[model samples]
Target: MNVILIGYMASGKSTIGRVLAEKLNHHFIDLDDYIEKKEQISIGNIFKSKGEIYFRKLEKKYLKAILENENHVVLSLGGGTPCYGDNMNLILNDANSISIYLKTSIAALVSRLKNEKSKRPLIAHIETDDLLAEFIGKHLFERSQYYNLAETKIVTDGKAGTEIVEELMATLL
Candidate 1:
């Protein structure tokens, strides 16, 4: 089975994905890193050079490819992956996979992402805590529609990584 973890930036998709994969003994594929390797460019550069439309196309193709090509893998999707094209539909329709939304509060998200904004292109231009909070509040509200479609949702607020993993394991079982 493929375990797909979906969430907004800094919601711990990549970090949790790694630990989950280790526990499950499944390969962990971080979608952004996968795309970077395949395209031979950073996701940030891809956005700058090729634009979001092109990046979304690539994201769709690879998201599909990875699901089709492997089983027993933990795949962590980018923040916007489910919001683009028919991607959420594709994820929902897969029988061999289960998608989990790492639901986090906007306050928690802002706290997690503020220091990491430079690494994330979409919010890199944002300045100050107030601006970051506003941006995240709006973005999370918009993105929650797609995220809520996940088969399972895990609230990650104030929870330790191992605690979240334990919850995930319980849900999976």
Candidate 2:
């Protein structure tokens, strides 16, 4: 079976996916990395040189390809992955895969993302912790609709990666 981990930026989707994949003996794929490799450019560069719309189309294309071809793998998607196109439907309806939401609170997300804002195009323009918090609050509210479509939801506020992996294993088993 495949596991798809979805969440807001810095919510540990890629980190959890790596550990979970090791435990489950599954291959791990960070969709952004996958896209970067295939496109021969960094995700940030893609957004800068190409644009979000082009990147989203590529995201959809690659996401569907992975879902169709891979098995026993953990796929960690970009923060906005589920919110675009029919991607949420694809993740929810796929028979061989389970979609999981790493449901992080606004405070946690702001704390995690503030220092690393430069790395994230979407939030890079956001200045000040207060503004970041406000942005995350509103963004999470909107994205939660798509994220909640996941088969499993795990909160990562004060949990370690190992602990989160255990929670996911329990659900998957």
Q: For each candidate, what is the lDDT?
A: 0.95, 0.95
For model 1 the TM-score comes to 0.98
Cα lDDT of model 1 by residue, 1-48, tens digit: 999999998999999999999999999999999999999999999989
Worst 10 residues of 1 by lDDT: 109-118
TM-scores, all candidates, are 0.98, 0.98
Which candidate has the highest lDDT of all?
1
For each candidate in turn, give its C-alpha RMSD to the true structure in angstroms: 0.6, 0.7
lDDT of 2: 0.95
Candidate 2, run of 10 with poorest lDDT: 103-112
List of clashing residue pairs for candidate 2:
none
Candidate 2 RMSD computed on C-alpha atoms after optimal superposition onto the true structure: 0.7
Q: Any runs in candidate 2 off by more than 4 Å, and if so which? A: none
